[model samples]
Target: MKAIIAKSNIGGVITTPPSKSYTIRALLAAALASGQSRIFNPLVADDTEAAAEVLTQLGAGIKRQTDCWEVTGGNLAPPSSPHQKLNCRQSAATLRFLAPICAALQGTSCITFAPGLARRPMTPLFDIFQQLGVRSELTENSLNIHGTGGQFKSNEVSLPGNISSQFISGILMATPLASEGLTIHLTTPAESKNYLRMTIDCLQRFGINVEYDDNLEEFRVEHQAYQPTDYIVEGDWSSASYFLGMGALSGPVTVTGLNADSFQADRFMLNCLRRMGAEVIINGDSVTVNSSPLRKTDTGLNEAIDLLPSVACLAGVSAGESVITGLDRARLKESDRVTAVADNLKQMGIKVIEESDRLTITGGTPRGAVIDSFDDHRIAMAFAMLAAICGDTVIEGAECVNKTYPDFWEDFQKVGGKVSINE
Candidate 1:
């Protein structure tokens, strides 16, 4: 689908969507728990749906009620009867996290994905799985996993941090079920440490114990079982970043339903915008941001790569050129975000310089152009905000925003932005 966004200044309060990161983890934990688990304020996104389907394939009973999801956890075993192949599409979180859990279950199972995810590198995860005595094979777009129904041996494994942290998080989630537990050692400084923190925090919520030694660079997960509990998913800070950018570009805007102390790395967008001279006020679960003249300065945003797309939008309207660095890891995301942002911005008649790991956006008035989303949700939302400044910007695959925020276009229109969807 394509969408044409007409220019207009943004205003009004927007409630952030439920956190995909937290919802996925909470759903997985509920599936692994021994009893019934209720997940409140769940994120109804494509990725979360993929996770729920995976759990159902692995012998968990899930029922969606009015506003909450009810998950009845059972033994962590693959279906006893013949099962249909699982399709994860392009959800990297589901593929990375569920693959290990599937490998640990008893029975044969296979997972296939669409072109986008099929091409992503899974060799790192394969290596880690091999060390845990799990056998898997990659053929075309399908990954066939056979479980031995045996305990995994604990070992010290070092992983590259520059790729996706989901690799480590997946292994960490499965390690608690190992017979001897597992110790993961990072070979390099881990980027997106905040995400790992979220993973650990979610594991603890489900009754798993994980110990981190920062000085030693080791994360140890003790062998334990997950207990069923009610999990409440908070609002997504990543989604809130777009509205914050809108406020930074036009006028005051308040985003409700986000926690002030979210573990999401994108929450740091508040700090980055403040550092760039935007007036940001946080109250409990809401944040109010007002437009102010921004100053360009070299800012360290390594921990907040998820906010890069929205940050690029804000930077386009800043008074001076802004340099965003330490984002080499962004290439492995849904799209080569670094290149996508630069390419999309340039199409909108903005000057942007791209590097292997950095983006230098020279702030100036934007002009309308047809922009490609690269089939990424964040890309679609980011350019939508840019349209507010550029006027008549057309976004191809704007429906991709349904991956995270299905109501994005409607919410944007409610905030005084006009969008025409072409099916």
Candidate 2:
């Protein structure tokens, strides 16, 4: 899919979409509980659907409604046969979270994924599984795992923290089912600790508790059962980033339904925009960003890695060169986002200096050019915002936004962005 964008001034009020991370976490927690749990305002995107499908395959009863999903959990049955597969599609969270949970259940289950997810790093989780005496066989795109019948041999394990926060979250979610409490030690300083905070927040709502130190290198989880509870997913700051950037570049835009106190890493977008000299207003659950001449700002993405692409786009048109550091982990996402952002900016006639851990972008009058999205959702959306400013910009793989925001283009139009789609 391709989306051709024309330059335009955008101003409107948009209700933020539900958080994908919170939706999946709530679904998994609900699926682990012993009774029925109702999740309200859950995200209906590709990733969340993948998590729900994987849980259904694991014997959880899920009833989909207009605005709520009722999940009956606590009686997980292993795959009926070795041929019965649990497909997680392209959602990395689904695979990571379910792999550990399946390992603690009885019977054999084969977890399979698309090629994109297959290329992600899973060795850390597999190595930890070995310490827990969970037998597993791996293929290029599938994992054939044998459960310990609900008990891990080891209660303590260690792994690197810089790779992916999902690994830590996966372990924390599954630990409650283990016979003994588990202690997780991180060999390196942890990045993206906000995600772990989100996971802990969701777990606590379902009657589970997690403890960690200030530095977030170690975690302690006691054996407990998940209690069924009603969960309401908050609005996503991640998806709202593009529109926020649009407001900064174009006109006043207000986005509602956001939580002022959210553990989501992307919630830092407001701070980032403020640092860049964009006018940001907060009124209750709504945030409004007004068009302003932005100045150069040096920012670190270690805690909010997902904002790399959008931040880079904003930097391209700022007043001076902007430095974005702590980007080493960004390369390991759905695409090499650092390279993608650099390439796209260069195509638009912007000056960019790319490095392994940082990017230096010089503000300039960007010209419209064809952008390759690399089939990454963030890349597509970020560039789309840039396109509204650049005009005559064509974004390839524009449909990729379905991974997180299915109605992104529609919302773009709602905000007065002029675009034509080609399928």
How much does each candidate deviate from the true structure in C-alpha RMSD?
A: 1.6, 1.0
- 353: Cα error in model 1, Å: 1.4
Q: Any runs in candidate 2 off by more than 4 Å, and if so which? A: none
Residue-wise lDDT of candidate 1 within 321-385, one digit each (tens)?
Answer: 89998887778778999999999988877799999989999988788989999999999998888
Where is model 1 more than 4 Å wrong at Cα?
A: 81-83
How accurate locally is residue 38 in candidate 1, as Cα lDDT from 0 to 100?
94
Q: How close is candidate 2 to the true structure, as a TM-score?
A: 0.98
Note the Cα lDDT for every prediction shown.
0.84, 0.92
lDDT of 2: 0.92
lDDT of 2 by residue, 33-74 (tens): 999999999999999999999899888899998989999999
